[model samples]
Target: MASHSFQTVFAVPMTCGGCAKSVSDSLYKLDGINKVEANVKDQVVSVEGTAAPSAIVEAIQATGKDAILRGSGSSDSAAVSILESFFEPDARANQETPDDGVTRDVRGLARMVQVSPTSTLIDLTVHGVAPGSYRATIRQTGDLKDGAASTGGIWSDQGAGDGSGPRGLLGSFTVGPDGRGSAYINNPFQIWEAIGRAMVVSRQDESAGPLKNDPDTVVGVIARSAGVWDNDKSVCSCTGKTLWEERKDEVERGML
Candidate 1:
């Protein structure tokens, strides 16, 4: 199905008009993009498209420049969740380590953008984990004190289902041999409906019941994300670090 178009803002370093034109041309080559605007002075690029934000970042990076997502969608249309694995200290110590000797509790990230009143786009990305199939779902509560166990049952939209089958099945995706995977999903719900809820990706299927005590299962609360033009800070006020500096830290933490 064709996804509804929304605007996404990206921070890209550009020194001149030529640089701006080059960035614009690169984005134009991508599918689902309808408009591209590159501002050299501001070092920012604005794109209107149905393409996933990851795809846009990849396209911009193809030009040998880094692309940082400043914001996406409009107003309160965007949301995000940082999926992390939860386990006991002993169990965590027993898990396999990465090749680089870095232990990452974070497994994936889910970016949600509401394009229309009834449809929302979810850009799910996972990395640094076992290569296998996993189910993605929205849970009823945001509590994570006990991990997935405290998140409650699957969340279903009012009057949408017959209440007989899997309730909040967003879908399933598979991680690859390189321990990386991504899925662009469209769900029949608005952004507001999912805020403060919990998103879980697990090795179990929908019929397996609530995910708990599973070392591989990852969960996070869905939180609001900044929209297009809503965030303009080049430096984080809390950490006092430049955006690129923070990006480097994120990279080390296995956040691709």
Candidate 2:
């Protein structure tokens, strides 16, 4: 893999050694990266290697932490592409698992505007989430056809954002006093293959207070692309004669 000596810095809120380890472990696994350093005292991570600033930031996010670009050694020489995603909330009918102590007052939407044969752009908007740190991740689905209404169901990390570190690590987000936040990421995944899968916004495990923690950090679902909904050929096949087609046929001969 080609590498650059670009050094990028980010401000992250790390509470202890474990949090720093999580950030390092997730970031070191990416290609083109050589070194990862996190200073808990400074609440910052300085990365040195040949990875794009955006990709490096994303890798750090997979660990349930947020990475913000401070400065890059290469300046503006890097080019990044962004694809849009479908945004929505999780299924609400299941309720298979209790939320533990997570608040459900939040509503969020995710969108992947476009995708190539193997990659996509993930954009998100969150409102009403308690102001703090949260994780956004994509998970393997058990049987849910649509992620938008999932109350509780089977979920496994889809591996990594681009098969490199972790899928659930779409990136970390923070809600402000207004209880809103937003994030954008470029990830590696096939949009079509991800349709039946699920994406969730979860509270950081360490951040969970008084309430016991469970997998229910889940907040909302990620929307699926338009193609996923249009796959059923029987819905609008465009081949059969419709009332409009028949009416036109009759009108041609004044049979109406």
Candidate 3:
């Protein structure tokens, strides 16, 4: 078997020794993986083996954390490419439409459907919207898909959103003549956020106090929600509190 090794950066909220072990064990389960070494202090993981990078990433994701392949190598580079491949360009380019119809901008119409261990697919519908170039920001939180938790991380149009400075455009979506179209953005932020929100809701339902001593879940939720606020930059007034404080306040007020 051809021997290959590569390093990937993961945004892991490893608050304790147990959390680090959990992440390591999860990565070690991939096929063709010879060994998995994680640096809890630096949030980096190095995998050695002939396994495909995508497979490794999928395995890590199955553990309910976000990871991205970084560094140099065919495997690492290819992994990034595979992730980016999920994004599809405009289906109906340069199409004209009626001037008096209600138009839903691209960002407003895009719907996030399925988020798998390694991928997220969003469906965008342009029905009943006017035709024009609309910009939108796609952001996400870092948490487990099934777990009720939150984390922080956001991926938006390269240069078309709140933080885009002169290059960023506000949230918008385009409408076509047929009023139907779609776009897809692949990143780890949204997955994390979904997981974090679920965690918050779960704890809320259980009547559990705000996450204390649970650094992973706490940081995860804060990171995720912060991303949401950043997309607009108006919410929270950009305070960007830590996960612990946010949880404390929410729990005290009976809010998750």
Candidate 4:
């Protein structure tokens, strides 16, 4: 079966912990509702599990309160968010050959999207490539080759299930007369799993072996939950924290 994990947020009015408990109890009783948390300070309730958005909204209404679908997604902010990253210059994430020592360049754009509860899609648009066929892969780190940070590497070709099996291929594209094209793959993994990784396009002939060591290949970032951070003040009282507070922790811990 396909993954059914989903997250839905509702605007619920609560005056105290008792109100929160009431809302939580009502939502928790519903089938497929894995986690139901209420925040009285934010006047919102966040539900995570396999339940549908409409059903979740209805369940919140059953508590004799109003429920608005403020957010519906898979994990965190990426559940319904679209993220984008760009390829680097030094990393062989591109295909460039010099003509009489006049070296050309490749430009790339990587997009990560959560199309459903259990699946995410990686879309790539690459330009300035040599006129030929090429393959793309998602790696563990978004760092470049000999980049200022740690050098980059690929986890597997198992992004869209069309490459090398199990570890499916992300997808392939052929450079056109304009030296650019687009490709996309629907990955079985969640958006969170790939949001912080690297996406690299390689030569079709295995001439570059693995993308990590390919001098012609470049490494670009795969950012997660790119948007939806506007005026978002939702908080967890149990942790006494909001997303901003958590980010502060990451910054202090050097995890961001």
Q: Pick the candidate with the highest TM-score.
A: 1
Model with the higher TM-score, candidate 2 or 3: 2
Put down candidate 3 lDDT per residue, 165-194, tens digits, no spaces: 321111334446653333333322323334
Task: Report how far residue 49 has shifted in candidate 3, in Å.
Answer: 1.7
Error of 1 at 63 (Å): 1.6
Question: Between prediction 1 and prediction 4, which has the larger TM-score?
Answer: 1
Candidate 1: clashing pairs of residues = none
lDDT of 1: 0.84
Candidate 4 residues 143-203, lDDT tens each? 5433312434446634444444534346576878776666645566766666556666766
Q: What C-alpha lDDT values do all the predictions have?
A: 0.84, 0.51, 0.35, 0.55
Q: Residue 192 deviation, candidate 3, in Å? A: 33
By TM-score, how accurate is candidate 1? 0.88
Give the C-alpha miss distance for residue 124 in model 2, angstroms.
0.3
Residue-by-residue lDDT tens digits, candidate 1, 22-73: 8899989988989999998899999998889988888888888898898999
lDDT of 2: 0.51
Estimate TM-scores for all models.
0.88, 0.39, 0.31, 0.44
Clashes of each: 0, 24, 33, 13
lDDT of 1 at 1: 42
